[model samples]
Target: MSETINTPRQETVTAGISEAKLLGSLKHLFASSFSVLGELMQNARRARASGVTFDFDPDQKTLTVCDDGTGIADFQNLVVLAQSGWDDETMLTENPFGMGLFSVLFACEEVTFRSRGRRLRVSIDAVVEKRAIAVDVDESAPVQGTRIEMRNLAPNLLPAKHEVPSAGIVGLARYEMVEELRAYAQGFAIPVRLNGEDLPRPFAQENIPGEKTDIGFVSVYGIHRAPDRQVVMVNAHAYNVYFLQGLPINGSAVRNGTPCVIVHLDNASFIPKMPDRAHLYDQERAFKRISTSLTELVERYLVDRKAKLTPKEFASRHWTECKVFRRLDLMNDVPWIPASLFFRIGAILESSERMMDRCTALATTAQGDPEAHLLSREDVEQGKFRIWRNTPYAPSASRAAALLLKVMQREEVLALADNLPEGHWLNLCTPDCEGFTFDVHASGCAGKADYHAGDWMSKVTIQLASQAEIVINDPDQRMTPLRCIVEDDWLLLPAGFTERKAFNADLPFGDHEAVCLVIGRGIRWDHPVDALSSYTDENDEYRDDWQENSARLWNALVSGLRGDSIADLVATALNTCTEVVASECHLPHMAVVRTTLAEPGTRVRNAPRMEVVCLQDDAFWESFAASFDSAGDTALKQRLRDAFVATVRPGEIIRTAE
Candidate 1:
């Protein structure tokens, strides 16, 4: 430490330089073999090097770098560079902080420098002595360039065997993201090679997951600019960072993991870097901005790439994203842009006949045809890999889903009824059965038979022979009575069943996932709560959206109630009710409403039956017609009435609450 002179007459004291500490600081910056290469490459680039080459020998555990650049005239300047700062005097070495070449020697056990008919050999001990470095000059003609040979590198300095890439050189512009490198390496004159092959280019984050197959001693030759960079996938695997034609820093130097080699094309332009050139200095927030910009660019690239797709590719991607991703909006946007591009490209992208085929395939998949699997397989064979189709996301995706839903259904659904009172398994809509009972006392309704008299609820009794029964205890939340009925067995299959609310209902509790069963009937209801009107007043100001949604829901319910009273209409009502309940709220509903025709003042008898209503299509009708042929007249009529059902058209598309 320098002592400050308090007295005017006292002379100032200065601290002497610690050579050991000075060299120690620079050594850590180039600890690894790749990091050492990064520092050295910069020095070569600074010398206006037109080309660089790297040679690795596994036998000797040695590395040699030769660069065709202006040669160093004075060998002693290396020692000066080893201890200088970012002053004008140090700038004479063409290095900002003058540590690059010195650190390269620090990382290696032994280093030899050959340039302009001069040779110098350096070791840690020789560098510490400052004068022991061996120098020999033949004075014979030599190449006007520089060559560095390093051996016996520090422990863990070189990449592990598994960490090394299978192909391309480890530390040069050899192999990385190939498509991107080829596009960006056009302007640079420095022809850098690693293991004799060009380096790979950068892939975006999403794409990087797919490139795990190529992970290893990664090297890259070039970088795509912003928008293009955004399109590439992000590789989470360890990677080496290179700036311009040289590596200024590596991801491992700052943090360690399966290191992600992050290369920035013009990082130096906007990113603040440390003086040692080892890392981006205090630029976490800045890096986020770069990441965001790159992400947006990637999105742009995807849109552009999509424009050039064949109809088959477009349809395949659409189906994959939609069926697998369950993103209909995304699917809608994909093909439209590609179609416009097809026309612009003179319709050469795909034939008109192919478009029809793609549409047919897409329609078949949309219609729930298993043959759609074949179409997706064909798509995979054509270069566009689909995750949602043939992969686990395909029908196989249900395996995991089934396992998960089994546990969830047991806990969330069946177990939920455990809280309900015993024998209180029927909904309000189900009439009192001879064997079953209801907790009308707990419902706050035993005192008044007239309570909720006209407004009744439908009770659902699910019977699985081997499993415990599930009953709808409370039919509607607004009603005071806690209704329940227990009844038949249906093993809820995991197929064609979802616990998702397919629509956004404007009603309360509409956002909840619909309780759908696989092998049995799913419950749905629509009963107007005479009391709910008080919650929504005519004078109260409501948004147009709320009013419109309410109007639409009421219309659908009224339309369902007004439909023909046949078995098909009954199935349609049940299906519509379930869909509405899934999207909005579950209310009292049934396939049939049995009402007695007594005098207006007289009491009417109402009996409730919870039964499964199947929207039997023509296929089912035809299949049942033959087997139902040979039977007794009364028995056959009863069987036909129970089994045969007319098909109802699917529910219309509803407007979004969003």
Candidate 2:
């Protein structure tokens, strides 16, 4: 009994398919209903089919696809999932998953395959219920080819009932099906036809000019055409489209300033994902290799072109690519900086030719070459000689200086002021003026400037005129000057001013003009004074309060400058008063006295008051009640009401201010 040993029994088990999983997969197998066309087209191409025809019968509610391919010998292979019934050559060259027919069944209620004197009809309901589909003998079937008919298509696959037939097309057919055929067969190998008309088809590689490499046929688009036929890579659209075996694969092409390059895999080693086969399989490593090869190909072309072309020409052609690829060595003698890094201020000129002409390319601080001219703070401050400036339009001079100097060394500069205090930084650059401070004291603006010298060189504190508003012409105005307004100055312009008031406010202004001193402490020569280039609240959308105050100040300045009376100012104020009554008070009709009451008058000193006419409608009353409730100033609201009811019909409420 002690010597007896119990033997443990072991049975061999293999992985089994789950019925529920298979049915679930059938439901979500194809990404798009249009994928059915692609799957069928793939089958036809892999079978070495010369031509495939698709015919739709509206009366029978069937779509027939007849292909002159090597017909199916064994009907069972069509029913068996993952069992491709193709020759070794087809299997080796194009990986087939044998799951394509399921896409047809999924899209249609019933499917019939007639090939090699045998016919098989499979119902989608039967497949869903896991029922057996039987193949039958058919003497009328095509002897050496396959003919498939899909009947009772899914609702989404049906043709539009009330659609106008396209040009040259004669029957009621799904336009979507036609479009699907066009997209899938555009780069397919075999010719495809619909309703006796040949579908337009072209291999992606054949249409593009590219060289074949070990991985694929690489083609570059968005290339500039030079006079000497040299490579120009500026302003190219990046390629996001990818192809394998003349079929498109889903790949994201990042769009940037770089050149767009398309890749069509010519090598047979590529494998597609199963089922729909719209994307690559677990070929990440293979794709990485392909990308590496593509990089090499582009690099070789650029390197070869660089040697033949001048440095300026090369930089002009492939600056974006060189920066991306870190091949700046090719730009050795190029004396130009990127326009985006510099010239976007005065004019919106983006042309490389214009940028080169208007700007002098100086060496970066890193290069201490004897011939290199490094611009100091004084050079930029003087602004007498034209030089390249950063285009970011940063708000403060310090921030802009930091942003530029972080990338390349440059001098901190200050623009000279037309009118300043005796000891202003702009006025005195003397040795004793190193630590001098200038405080700006003005109505509607306040700022302080401190000057620093020594190791930091010259640090000029920024003095922004927070309340100034003025428009100035941009610096570089070759073709046409780009209009720019200081953020605060723009805010000061009356938003709801009448045409007459706006015209009265339109005074002459420019960069070098004395308008800077009038608006704020002084002008900012470093960058544009737009709100975008300055610091402001991200959440601040509307600044309604600034309108009235800005208009008043602006009128005062304009009046003082012209030595005119307050007529224009009063007109502008009247316009603003009318706007507030109509827009804010929601008065149906409002009028402000435009003429002066004291114009050769006997006793009138000012315009008496504004007038508002109330409508008898309930909507007008509701708005009137809401305006009263929402207005913050009760006294103003009472005054508005007194002014409002002076003119009214029989049903309207009336109140006389007197």
Candidate 3:
């Protein structure tokens, strides 16, 4: 019984498995499978194979990629293919990354692999239940290189049928693949068959049409290896009409989708990575220098030889086409070169002579045009019409005038009173009085003809007068020796109290001439006195009296002073007065003073400390007080006043101080 119970010692093995890790690896596998062609091509390059084959069955939805590369050596490597961390250092002969093979499993349900040196064949199947499963390998018989046959292809994972058509599957007759492969193999060439057809060669030995026979040297800015990395310049015609190779890494034509000036190192390694996209314009600068130099050389050589050159000839002679440009229509997408430099070069070649002639003609015309001098003077004096220094005229007015002239097809003329001499004199004529008086001579029209009798003229004038009793009794309107005066051919009113009277005095006496007169209504001569008296009486203890006075001033600005026609001056005074008060008093008192200047309907409530102040029967003052409580500080109250004045309503009593 004791002899029957014998048992061997057991060994326990622990393996670490992470769900997140597995999911991530699976996602990478799926994404990598979509780019399987790149991987296989990489492997083919390492194997020194001329081309790689892609087999697809649309009906069955299957893709089989086979490369004539030095495949797996034995059953051991084949079994561990799905396993992570497979040693692939020795396979560095071509493919840099060994993970590409696993990416295939993501696209297909089953994968069969046969190596050249090995006699054993292995198959890998991805199990829906178990992450991945593989069959036991028979090392007794293995194939030479690697042959990967994948089945149950996910249609979505495959490249478009048109991108890698079945027709291109024939042997190495395709030139695109041949050119791509040539860069990898150096001088060695191999044939690739796709769908049983050979690929064709992409380029021939014929010289590019219209290329200049004589060699031309173009100076290029070299790379500056100090401070920061950047492209200096590239010689455009240096490698005219040459072909270049590119690696399809990460599914991009340029490195990281960046445009770069491809530079060939003396050691034969073309820098694969390009400058950042933000710095792509730097390449254009180099292109410009090269293109200019090359074009100059070509133009000099081809002088008097235009009749012998064709369109194609001209392109090849002056412009250089890079290999990247030929392989892909990248020039169309690259905004810097093809659109900028290439177009610039072409334009120069086509119009250089004509452009010079045009420039010469322009210079001569500038010296001959008499109106040019007048126009320049008008430009300098256009703003002189402003009433005050630094006053800005409406930009829209100028724009409208320019548009009108353009639409009417009239010669552009500056807005000058003297441009029409006859009209200028007529404008100065007194309509009601037969006598003619000139106030100011039109400086612009001094050299022109003078007004004569028996000439029919249309004249219009406007004069504004202050109707306020104070302004009427001020002696200027009544006792002035001269009511109107003419100086330098311009009519001026010496005693006009308001803009309306001044404007009306020159109006056509009998006939309406679109005249406008604004009678100064509520303007006052003693505004300061009235202001001080209003706050001095019962409201003197309110402490907001200054605010009320300030508000009145502000109202005077916006509403126009009762006895004055100049609203602009009143506004200026209000703004200046506020600053004066602010500089002289404490902030709270300043706030109270400023609030007084607010227009009617403007409100200023007391701060939190004064919220207990009850509202009176006057809704205006009550509303004003309410606003103060809501207003956090005096600055806020002033801002509220400014905002209210912008939209003040007529007849609304705005209480400035509460």
Which is the leading candidate under lDDT? 2
Task: Kindly list the per-residue Cα lDDT of model 3 for residues 1-658, writing each as its tens digit.
Answer: 3567668899899997774456346534343334454445545645545466666565566656566565554434333334322235423312233345555556566676655533332233333243443334446323434566777775555334234334433423233433333332221124444555553322211211122222221221211122112222233333232221213221223212212222211112111122111112243454364355444443443332224544333233222322212211211222111111101101000122331222211111244433222111122234211111110111111112111111111111112111111322212221211121212111121111111111011121222333211111112221112122112111112222232232113322222222112233322221211111223335434334554554454344334322233444434565756545433323222111111233345466422111122222234444664677764455655565556545543234458976
Q: Cα deviation in Å at residue 281, candidate 1?
A: 2.5
TM-score, per-candidate, Cα-based: 0.38, 0.54, 0.30
Residue-level lDDT tens digits of model 1 in 1-658: 9988776676899988888776656565553334455555555656667766667654466777787777777777777754433335325433355556676666678888888988888876666666666678846424677888889765545445343445334332232222222333322335555456643323323223311111112222122323212222333223433333334333332222322334434423433254344455455654555455544443443454457765445444433323222223333333221111111101110122322222211222333433333233233234242111111111112222222222222322111111112232121212221121122111111110111111111111211121223222222232223222211111222222233311111222211121112111111111122111212345754244543443344433333333335465455555645344443322222132343333344455433223453333434444455566744355555556454222222343458998
- For 1-658, candidate 2 gives per-residue lDDT tens digits of 3697889898889998896578657858677777787777777877778888888755566789989888888888877777889899877777777888888888888899999898999976677676788889999889877999999877677656556655456443346666666666665667888878887654445555667788777666533212233333322323345667666676332223323556667537788776666778776776677767765665776787778876555655665666555465555445432322232222111122332353334334444432223223354345532332222222122222222211111222111111222432322321111121111222454333222211112222223344422222222331122122333221212112222121112222221111122243222332212211112135744343443343344444433343344556556666756454434344444333232234345554643223333344445555665677774555655555556665432234477798
Off by over 4 Å in 3: 1-24, 29-33, 78-95, 117-144, 158-192, 199-246, 250-658
Worst 10 residues of 1 by lDDT: 340-349
lDDT of every predicted structure (CA atoms): 0.38, 0.51, 0.32
The candidates, ranked best first by lDDT, are 2, 1, 3
